[model samples]
Target: MVILLNCAHHLSQRLQTTFVNYGEATMYSLETCPSPWLRSHSVWGRYTVSFLLIITQLGFCSVYFMFMADNLQQIVEEVHVTSNTCQPRKFLVLTPILDIRIYMLTILPFLIMLVFIRNLKVLSVFSTMANITTLGSMILIFEYIIQDIPDPSNLPLMANWKTFLLFFGTAIFTFEGVGMVLPLKNQMKNPQHFPLVLYVGMSLVIFLYSCLGILGYMKFGSDTQASITLNLPNCWLYQSVKLMYSVGIFFTYALQFHVPAEIIIPFAVSQVSQPSSSPAWTWSSP
Candidate 1:
């Protein structure tokens, strides 16, 4: 929360400075900044930010793939475990398709297609839907956590330095919304209200992250998977929740991919001859 507020304050300052210096408020993406480093005018800065953004987006995509695959695997495995008549089959049957890698591949093309949608305006609707589904998933997760309260004595209050480092990294990654702040603020109909929006939105984000992190660790202890959704009970409702959350993450992948795609695609297009041959290339062409 503090980090969010700090970022918001910094962004607010930057926006104000830009308005004062330029004599008008205008949308400014990271690459449009006056600073050579931020705007990527320098070779080092351009490559560094480009690599980091692409790597980060790829990391997010891989995580989403794993998340959906794991949940789907769990759903299928649980179904078989609970059902008496279900038998393991060979020779490339429907059961074989339940494999995690299969699930990952099944959803991969859809994600690729989604990334083709370069327009933020069109993607915003899906982003809103993703937020809604994510919220619903969180509520369901909270219900599950509260229903099975763990004894506090069994949970550790502190961890070793190594574990603390892990926690720190995780927390940083969880709250890494600073990069999105400027673009989001720029897109606002009334950019002046962005500070208020940031405060309210990030407050909720912090609250949710804190509640989920603390309660999830408390509930699952050492048995927790990378995602709390994997630890959910083997029930139809919980299974549905996992599916819903996967869909949300799937939608979110486009948003994450948008950043690096926008950064790299234009540059790539400008280098290529006859970029207008491809629709995506034309759309991204400088």
Candidate 2:
């Protein structure tokens, strides 16, 4: 961005200088030059470009889920004493799909509307609620999974007190909404609405998670995979649900580092566009 900005600035200056040198001979102004043309061309292009991104992600997700489902029975058959739960691969992968579904269908669309949303305060409240609820869901899931380990097979993995502590401690990965919290916080227009959103979100999260966990526990008991896939006895439902979940997750996690990249890209490009600065490190936004 820095490089682009510098190039824009330099080109603007050069155009003005050229016009002055030409002295009334040139019909075109700097605004009509190639730099401005490019700027105009690309200014609203991100919105359109983002559409293609969603399509590509969805396609990849479909293929991935299909491949996984085809091998799922074989994968399940391979499980032995060492493999107590379906969560090692399936759950880890599926939860992200759930997260992505919430983000794209719910959060992302809502956020995009933030630009033109009339009810800034209300929307902020909603966003805060969403984040808090998301966090609550994470916490509840962690608690349930930790406590509801029905299979004695996993007990050895948590044999020692120190090891037990490590297992629960590392469970933070299940609740990893820290990456999203700050952005939600900053976007809130009414600070007072935050607490309300958090409370509501948490309550919803707890309720949904408890219900889901209970249903899950009841359905599979000892056979419970960390994810829905292993718990699903019906092959068709397993494939369908897994497909949907994987697609959603692929979108959300794939952009986990987007916030930091957003900050870095502009500056890198700006520096590159300058005469004395190093070349910019711009790449296609993934």
Candidate 3:
């Protein structure tokens, strides 16, 4: 009888232990299954993608600056010499289309593509970069206006075709990256505000460029280069201004190259300037 009792007691304890073990294992499996895969992929995949993007952006900007700087410098010197004495060269370039103005056309196609991007935050960062370039150009232009135009010039106006052309270029500068706006806008946390941001941002850009263009043109006149960098005055001032403008151009290219890189490889989207947590919006469900 005692033997039978002992056997029965042992069976009960064994059953209890098995139930507890199975319960704990089930909970552990559930908690770990979904998260481990996600964490691992994010840590490894995200960094890899971002690093590749940075490399490509730097390469593109470096190439552009290397090839274009000399012609631009010559144009600036000529404009400055002519503005004070000679009749400004007959609208130097034959067609307005020849310069960065062509980039304005890129805005439409960029918007169409932006609609399909899945990440909003990445778009915001890109938009911010474009905004900075435009804003920087405007600031350069404004400095020219403040310095060059004199006599009843406390208020600046769009006085001539040259003025109009300069302003048009300013618009081009800001809107040049229009292609990236839509995608970046779509990725924003509150996309409705995107247009507002665009208007406010671009208006500020216009003001800056208009001022700079007027100043640079008045100071250098018709001899100004396609870029504002050439119009810089000689002396210590020119060196500092040159460095500042050069930095702006470099930054513009960084964002510009990033746009294509982000499009080609979604992973690269994270490489654009931003905090570590920024989401990369590469794809969208059609």
Specify the highest-lDDT model's number. 1
Model with the higher TM-score, candidate 1 or 3: 1
For 1-286, candidate 1 gives per-residue lDDT tens digits of: 3454344445458766421111011223444567766555444444565577667666766777788777777666666443333122121223544567887787788888998887667778898999899889888889888765778687777765777777766766674445455556556677668778877987888888888888888887877666676677655677678878888888877777776676667678778776456555454311
| Model 1 weakest lDDT span, ten residues long | 18-27
Task: Count steric clashes of candidate 2.
Answer: 15
Candidate 1 structure lDDT: 0.65
Instruction: Please write out the lDDT profile of model 3 over residues 8-59, one tens digit for every residue.
Output: 2343355553111111222333444568764445444434434544454445
TM-score: model 3 vs. ground truth:
0.41
lDDT of 1 at 95: 50
Q: Provide TM-scores for the models.
A: 0.74, 0.39, 0.41
Best prediction by TM-score: 1
**lDDT (tens digit, per residue) of candidate 2 on 20-101:** 1111112223334578664555523443433433344344434433434434333333333224333333333322223333
lDDT for 242 in candidate 3 is 50
After superposing candidate 3 on the true structure, give the runs of residues whose Cα lies further than 4 Å from its correct spot: 1-141, 148-174, 265-286
